[model samples]
Target: MDQQTIINSLPLHLRPFVKQQRYDDYTPRDQAVWRFVMKHLSRQLADSAHPIYKEGLERTGIALDHIPSIDEMNACLARLGWRAVVVDGFIPPAIFMEFQALKVLVIAVDMRSVDQIFYTPAPDILHESAGHAPFIVDIDYAEFLQRFGEIGMKAIASHADLEQYEAIRELSILKGCPQSSRQEIETAEEKLAKLCNTEQAPSEAALLTRLHWWTVEYGLVGDCEDYRIFGAGLLSSLGESQHCMDDTAVRKLPLTVDAVMSPYDITREQPQLFVTKSCKHLSQVLEEFAASMCFYRGGTESLRTAIAAQSVCSACYDSGVQVSGVFTEVLCDAVGNATYLRTTGPTQLAYRDREMLGHGVAHHADGFGSPIGHLKDFSRCLSEYTIDELKAHAIEIGQPTKLEYLSGITVEGTLQEVFRQDHRNLILSFSDCGVTDLHGRVLFAPEWGTYDLAVGSAICSVYGGVADKESLQLFKPTPRTSTLRVDVDPSLMACYSLVDRLRQQPAGLDADDGSIEDALLAALAQYPNEWLLRVEMLAVADSNLQQRLLEELRQLGTANKATEQLVAMALGDFPAPHEDRPASA
Candidate 1:
């Protein structure tokens, strides 16, 4: 029969049951058993089962007041051109498929006492009717089931080896398995089944079954709005239905074929629900599967992007960079402000002394004899640099100079180890690293500079961005107390470790002392004044223990200062301090 025609012929009231009903004659015990099963499972469904299950109860004319007889259900099915059949217990896959292909629901004649609720192997009347019936009424759902059954039977008949495929797919959909593990099990089963019959491997059909379950059986409705329950498992399970809708952690992601086959835990309520816009959408998915556009392996790009972004971003900010105290100092006789340089090339440009000299020629007299001299003067003229001036400098000098500022800081190796041990006590001090607050607009630096720090502020706004708020709260500087042990969150700490590891790599990407100082200043902007004081104290501790620590901090601060000075000089903020000094003097 044509799919839509079958759908059209279905009785309006019984349409919902078409997907759920199994045909079987009820003996006296069967009726009693149905009543007994319904009575107990009803309690579970009432509180947590999908709303559809309750609707099924009302729509299918199955009364909660008494056990429903098979004859009565068959009459309802017959009205919809469907029927119910009875099986002793477990039926062969082919027979089950045949029943479904004929638009007949198969109900197994078995009973589970109230005590045995926890364990029942085969589908008893309670499970067959109550657990799965309501969804059968939905035309799309019923069609999918019929198709699934037909496909399943064909595969079974074609190949004996496919039984394991059927079993594993059933187990996976009914139960969730991790993807790798599921694949392994499916592979083994397929190989074993193949030994028997290669013509029809159950693996392919089994995958479709899983897809059907994910989309048609346990699928959810709606997007960010109200989600209606539709899947038969959810429709049947009282507790799961309630839990899925109410749980905050139970995210409803857009459904895709991969997500259905993806591992999940069925014993527990799903932590995530696969949501479809409508039943038609699900039907379309099956149609695609029938056409063979959807494959069993390979995932979508969006999924990969989500995984990568989440993995990298999840690491704590503390792990990426450390900040200390801020120091504002004036330079005496520096020749020129340090120029801000940005890398505009497609590939990353390496910044070395020679490169700095080449870029510094137009701005600094006699090229760059000492980058430090330029850096100090740059810090003194911080007020003069404009955004444009900084950008121009960065474009010419390249991004490497930014790394130069961080050079000599022991951010790698032993220093990192020391900081790790006593992160609370160690202060990451900042000097006038060429970064300017710009009224919270941008974090401007000369020689690889000018970033959208305003966006940083917005992200770090206590009221917004998760990353910003979390970083600020965790790293906010505070006075050291005996009980105060500053420990970076594990994720952030990992970032810091990554940075350190990257620095050690041959490329030499370590943040120079100046860049480090600038980064600290940027970080500190998110916190209160007290946090600055705490940072200063920590810096002092490091200064006392390691001479390199202070020098590096000074360099970082100086580099920042130079970048700003260069920008200021370029923008005509003030005369370059050393330009006026006698060349001989």
Candidate 2:
């Protein structure tokens, strides 16, 4: 989204709302409150917020000295054909929408003392004007809000329950309870505590409320590369502002509608944040949502039905091959169609078969008798031993295979003594034992020579020397190997190859020493034969580089799992700020 264009297009009236003058209208007390709030919130913002939000404050011309007057704000907004109105208190949903249709921004003018920060039931001037007004000047943001208002009005006109509309809107506004008076704040907080204690509150409402508190109220922006703050709630608070940007406890994830809607607790500093690439992207998302609802009154399914369906891709892995490292998952679900795939777990691998061999264990062995061939040959094989079979084997051999003999082994026991010995010449062996030699080969050794026996006997005995020459020469028959082959999904192969290459490059290549495009190309090249066509398709889809590379990949039919991950890597997540909630007592 073009932020500069949005800024350029903001109506003259609304421009003032973004300026510091609106805050100047504040009374001495209001100014004191603003200063106090700013001081605290600013501190919090510095810790967890996006840099854009701070920029927004600078753009809005808000200063630490005063409370902005509604009239003065309205005057500034008037230039952009926007106006701010003082509300008696919480306005009805109908009025809220009506104000939006008319392009008049309504903010409840209330204030809280430092002592009263924990509880409030009425929309105070701090919560509304400070929490919401600046974004009103952002053209795309203003459009988003207007569209939201329109959709909300339509829903109301259609006789959709006012409660549901209120609930959803509350999810976007009212970070927590807003009080009309000190007494009211105290009473409302008591009620909330009772409700929480009783556990009778609707879980969905609680979830939505928490989501609003976190994202709309205190959400942060940026990743490791860069970040800024934009949420109104954060913009208005002093301490929260600093805490959000610097704290280590916070967990940040890329923004998604589901993630935004997810529940959170607002009483303390947030442990996580949902980040978007930019406010413009968020505005576009909201716009798309509004449009979607207009077209599909019942919901998203109708849209899905209208579009051609894409085939779903599934990742397959070998059973015994443990992937004990981090990997990425990408899922694509347009408004109407939804599908998900994950590439996470132990003993699992996901890759396009065409670009690389199917998921399997690598093997190493000694000469022709080595089981390395078996590992390389078998595709998608599971090493299984039924409890009964294991028991039988234990009875016959006096013990089942020790944990040391197993690949990806987990077991509990102790080996007392070495029973067998064969030392004469270098010996080769094979077993279904699931052990790997030094060459990344999966091998099975059958005969227990002194050398092998000592290693397998127990952890303590592993270093014992061979007793005799005859104890070292053990042999086993060469087992027939069945080669396993898996077809790689060309697109995935290319992506993985590209990522791997980029990871190997010197970190100083790009300005940040990181080049997403370069990394992508390298990952693709790593599996040249398998992903050539896929790479070509991706390049063609993204030929203009106008859309996000991941989005373009989706358009080119790349697996959602891979694309989602690549996008996440490009954009990092930051923790949102915490909303001030009423104390339970």
Candidate 3:
């Protein structure tokens, strides 16, 4: 399929989060940050990262010297059955997974600032494109990513999940913006920390996301004791990648379903990492977790899970009809089998992931409710009954119909319609129907409008979100906020622009003359702490200027260990930072 065709096929709800890359928005300094991180990361990762990392970079069209645009990535990714879209900051996790399930990668729209060249807490182009896209060259890993998305979208989430996601997202946004105050970042950090420590039980979605964090975000390949870097988190962060392999600081655990028990914090470096045996093994562990999710094992338990979540979800009946809405209550019998279930507001009925004719949310805007078990005399689910069989039960259009269930739920009305698909009756509509439970409690009043009964014996599967996502937009898309653009003084940008221009034209620098070095020194005198600019100046500076640049860098290096290491790294002395641990890492 063509790239646009594949991307357009993504669900309607996900499109709102997608934004234009606006390639021109990247400032000259932004370009410098991308080059600095990519050049250094590629060099160090050349030895420790997976072999696929190097080859994938070429195939994926991730440029080491420039911030790659969405169109550029799409051209290359389309060849591998993938496409790229730009998104601002953090999007909802569920929406992100949905995009992935369609084989579309969402590249963050912003680049990290020069100060955050080592690591940025927020989602950036560096983390999403350079960190992730390269690995898609491996077919096995690509499949795993899609499968992860498939399973992730269906996993049941808790009420706190969105709140927690928003907290972390806020923190990342605050940290990424260069103008953000210390107090703002600290407040966001406190809020996220509190949410992390909440006493509420973890939901299936939360646990499954934990597994995603371990394997896809920060995973290693090989044995627990020894491994190569593959996860995007480590692959993107210069400091984390260097320090992560350390045994004393970050414990390496063997990848398994149990990895879900270990939650991750986005604000801090992980104290531990999981190592899978291979790329294929990543999916194996994921499937193990998938097998345990409510979407796979549905019944009264899954219904209860949906009720606890208090969000939009889908429950598939054995008869192949699906009810999608916020589950409010479930009525069970003496032995604990669900007798009837109800959804509160705006529900939809779907079959095979498509909205049924005249059974969308508009038709059932108030809510939807139905009996859960087989009828008294019918050994088969009512949906399985043929037209002739229903005639035997005196259930024909415009005829009086009375249905009794084993759970004492009764429906009495004149049959209005029977919606069928693939030779199965998916829904039965009745006029002036009065539904009553065993205690004579009216489930549905006769005065109400047409009663649409979903046909099924019991819920066979339950999952997050509406079944017909393309037809039903259940959640509101978070408003897109543009990532922080560098709007600094023009003079400051002039220096960065100079360095950026120097990179594009290497021949501009002449060792025979010290003009370029003198120009850079004049620029540096204004911005005293622009260490990266100094490091960039090192490449083309003559011996006299190179010595001067080193001396200045050495003085700036004393300000902090990160600076010290960067200057040392530029000089190639002591391998700069700790490959095992950056200072205080």
Candidate 4:
């Protein structure tokens, strides 16, 4: 089957979600992510992975230069009687199984942002194209996958199963969202916890999917003592793939249908995995599974009995530790923004555990899963101390402590505290590493002279090294806090800084300098998504600079959605409507 044929075969409801893999749609960042993950994982997986995985990759012609085109991949898959198609992100388990049954692979269209370089909760090109697709070329393995899918589709699941699908999707988006605050992610996790602990038992389909997840997604192959990577989940992950092989603590058990059907959490690392004797043994196990599967023999009632006996899977919590007045805990997961279990109460010093994952916390409440939203800027309240006070505190704590500044730069310091007086904020601190901007550019090193960085502006490090940290044209303060903590990209920050500075200067035309706007235009070349941020910056600029920014926006043309929205905003005249701006743009 070809791309269109595969789409046509899918249920009409699912067809709209399937899209052509527009190879040109990928950006430089996407390419870089693909290259970085592959470069690191290739050597690690070479000896550890099933031999066919590397061979499939070579035959498919995926390389470091760019993302593979689906058409090209299908041409290779055709030889093995398989085809590949791209999906928006994650699909329903039934739809996913249907694709597998039809000998079609579903690749996620979006690539994870750099912030989630290690692992993304969502399936990406790395997991789909690079991980699962490579193994499809092994004819016997492919046949086993197809048969499993065929059997899987017969399993019945309730509507409640879909809740987890939405929860995970929302969690992935929130993690990658630059604007999402720490509190927001925690709240989302709490909601997910409630859904996971629902009174209803998991359906037959959900049970089968769990089995598929453990084996095909995160499974290992060989004896319990020794194993190789065959699962797509490990094969795609740079961290877990290596960790699974190197960590002796990770339990590897002999493959069995019962072990594979056991419940597992998507959030945390696997404490135990089922390992098969060989690739062919996988088929043998599936054959045995089919004979006993509820889908074929026992039906939904038996699957419900199994689900009722299974324990609820909850996210693991970070080891509790208190630094000064701040108490922090992280909800452990395989990847993405970890939810923090924080408190500002009296500190209790405990031995912090090294490996925090897999030790499941209580499902209902208390400890890690206790009600969230109690702590707010737990570290910010103690910012009142002077440099001397901070140094004393650091010695008392016995650590290389640091403090965050209102200016968005974090400095190496000791016992510092916060004071509030009207609107303006101040911090008294000392530093040995000196003060560095949000972009990691050293603004004040001991040997290096003090330098002020603006958007699109350049500076030399203490070692005299130069890189691409440009001064921005804007500075939009986040709603949750006073003083910018600067979580946004520097390019956007530079654009924000530009317009902010201009707004402070003069509103109308200024003859002082056009270089500021010129510099902004140059910076915008690489980061086109900075267009909306630039638009916000333009509102603060003088009339001349605003016009110049508009002209630059026009010059950018409608190359992509970001530029297209920018051009539309420019043409719409001054004061672009906020609601009209595309979220992606």
Candidate 5:
């Protein structure tokens, strides 16, 4: 099933939190804002953000030009044993933690406008994808996050805190709505400010949330005297990210339970930020906070820390949290999707396999793995096909794809050609056709009709057969104009080709006719502004190819705005900030 259809079919309980990244929802202005942020921050963040932050950006497939696709992100993240899911703005703290506990990164799909680009009052795509998604690439950091989520889920908040969460959610939803007026937004922001500025002390849940904000949201990394931003809040906002680093007025302190327990303001620039020495330090601080929790103090020891010490059977070389460099013998079912109890020394192992009945082994029929910790190969599934099989499954050549317009009119042809106009709108050429549709319901009187060919409506094939909704091809309509001009990124063509190839069968990394990558790279070199497309294709290339592309990008140097941003993003070292770069919004 297509992604949108699959999302629509999901049960109501999960639907709101897990939605599709409707890439088409983004408008031209949104794309412009994304590029603006990428161009500026890619250069501005050179000396400020943690090294892993940029690596995470590359690893997770987040690019500069367009809003990221969560499915594509998950494809890359899956290699690191993680996945990305789209959420509708801010979810409950506990729910957010629950998602992380499952090793799933929750991303907000909405993008901020150019006006609100510098600092979005609530969670948006910039904050989630650009700020948070990249850091998950580091195993230690990923494990630390999962553990934080596990702990945060149990850290119950007070009624007052819940009210604050609801208020924040309402404001975020309002801001994300393109139709929301300035007055309505101001009204919401006013109410949120009052809630944030309240003088009352925060509850345990609120304090824990504060900790999350200081660390995950606005926290810094490195020694107390010298640090860089790893926090999403700092990473996503151009104004704050730069101000926090440049302005000596902002106080920096080591990350600690006490430090985060203090209150903070959301409406204006923060006067202070806490820095952590490393992810391990954050983990230690988290455990310290967990130990002090009212729930833990009430005599219920967290199962997370216990399994590590009491359950070892000795002489094992398996998976799970590593303690004293010993493997914790994690088992799994026929497929690797379900991880069993008592796995590696890795902390994520505990939260990942929390349903064990005894000795970290699940009671289900998957059966407990022997304590011998022998490595099992579950790389390919029983029904999976090889690369050779995938190549054989490619769609037959010379078969022209069919696209249906308004009314009974049909356009049968292949993608005649595709290219970017100055690296902005993706231009696709279809075989010319004489106007038909005498009835004129689909396209008549020069009206505007936008349709997603894949799932929006029924289209017929060359054999006069109705197209299946499961098909991935989408037929988007251009505005009411003489020439067909659609405002989509040109990189989408290569993306469509890659997805089509993958759906047919798993292919090799450098496996296509090379036309798709060739077209993408040609566009990339021609349009320096197409950095996101470069990042997207680079993420798909095999390791060796990615390195080669990096070298090619480096060779370009600080030639232009696009190439400079491309080289900086492709390999985290950007040339000295060009005075010509976009000024902070």
Candidate 6:
């Protein structure tokens, strides 16, 4: 399947986030970066990573030599029951999860700069494709990833979380760009720091992201003492992959629902990693955590979470009716079960995820309020009462009716309408109504206009977001900010292009061509400080020139410990070294 066909198949709402991969946008240097990262990451992870990783890379459509194209990848992904779509860096987590739930991988379009070659702060194409898509070949891991999306998308998030998402997204984009100034980064950091302190408590979505960060992003697999690399954050990263292996610096713990309790810092290396017993164990731990979320655990327990979010949420009553709005208050009974709930803004009444007729945000534009317990003498729910039975009891429409609740609340009004669905009363509207507690504190007065009391016996469930998704766009995913492009000198680009030409040769080309060798030597002379060029040149250079390139690399490595480590690692494990290092370090 082609990218366009796969994209056309997506939900209309998600297609806006999908972008075209301008394969032409990648420069020769960019391809070199991809090759370098994949080459070393693969060799380093051969034994350390999950065994399927190498096979997965092949099964999925990633190539070791250059950046993988979407067309080839989508074709390969389709065979594994998945598809790939390119997105701009760092889409909203909920949106990302939604795509995953649909079994479509959200591949970020931006490639990391060579400057941040080890690891980039943003969700670049390298991380999204090389880090994530490789594991899609494994059925168990794929199912776990898809299931995570299904649950995570429903997780309730606070309005403040939206602000934080934009902040973090901005920081990642700026930091990933080589040309971004230190002052600009500091400003973004300050804003993100302020948002961090603003969160009084982690919302359901916030907590779920912790689990995702720990597992999908940076998780390990197997026992704490003996684990393999499965996390994309580790697999795509060269530095963290090695840093995490040091037992003294990075602690390893058994995977559990408790991982959610410890939040992660995306810009910094994690201090700890969670290890699952197996891929199946990942889903088990996920279920354990999910079972505790508001969407799964309903009633007053869930309502409080929604109320605290201070954003659009929904509460399902025992009568099967759901009210969605920015929840403000929840009156409780002696045992703390919700007795009466009130929403202070536009609220919609929905049943089975569909809006109820005559009751929507427009009708209740001001707000909504209703009781949520059984009637004083009723052995069953008020909604369950028959129309004839209600009329016999003097609660008929168009007549004066008064009712008492078990919670010491009373309703007196001229019943104007009884809204029923499948013979079950969903709402009872009244004119000239007066609702009050035993203490005579009026909940609703006659002057307030018609009162539409939701006819439910009790609160059954409460979760985040509107029950009817089509009701309102309460939250929008933060769209991606463009990654910056730092221009390189033409001569330097020419040199990179020449190296790329050598790399793509049917049979490995030696630097025996005088003009090619002169250009290589001129590049080495003009950009003497560059080490990656030397590394790239070392691969295609014959024995005679390899000695000269190795000498240059050694000199470059000596200036800094980082370069030293890179050259040492790249030369030792780069898989294309044609010459042996000198006996002297």
Misplaced by over 4 Å in model 3 are 1-9, 480-482, 511-518, 560-562, 573-585
How high is the CA lDDT of each candidate model?
Answer: 0.39, 0.39, 0.84, 0.55, 0.55, 0.85
Winner on lDDT (2 vs 6): 6
Q: Compared with the true structure, what per-residue lDDT tens digits does model 3 show for residues 171-239?
A: 777788878899988888889788878787899889988888998899999997778999999999988
In candidate 6, what are the lDDT values of residues 149-213, reduced to their tens digit? 99988888898997888888899888977788999999999998998996388889999999998
Candidate maximizing TM-score = 3
- What TM-score does structure 5 among the candidates reach? 0.51
Q: Candidate 1: deviation at residue 88, Å? A: 3.5
Model 1: lDDT of residue 162: 31
Per-prediction tally of clashes: 68, 88, 0, 32, 17, 0
TM-score of each: 0.37, 0.38, 0.93, 0.52, 0.51, 0.90
Between candidates 2 and 3, name the one with more favorable lDDT: 3
CA lDDT, candidate 2, residue 574: 17
lDDT score at residue 28, model 4, on the 0-100 scale? 45
RMSD of each: 39.9, 31.1, 4.8, 30.0, 27.7, 3.5
Clashes of 4: 32
RMSD of 1: 39.9
- Which residue pairs show backbone clashes in model 6? none
Better candidate by TM-score, 2 or 5? 5
> Which is better, 2 or 5, measured by lDDT?
5
Runs of candidate 5 exceeding 4 Å displacement: 1-16, 176-183, 186-200, 299-585
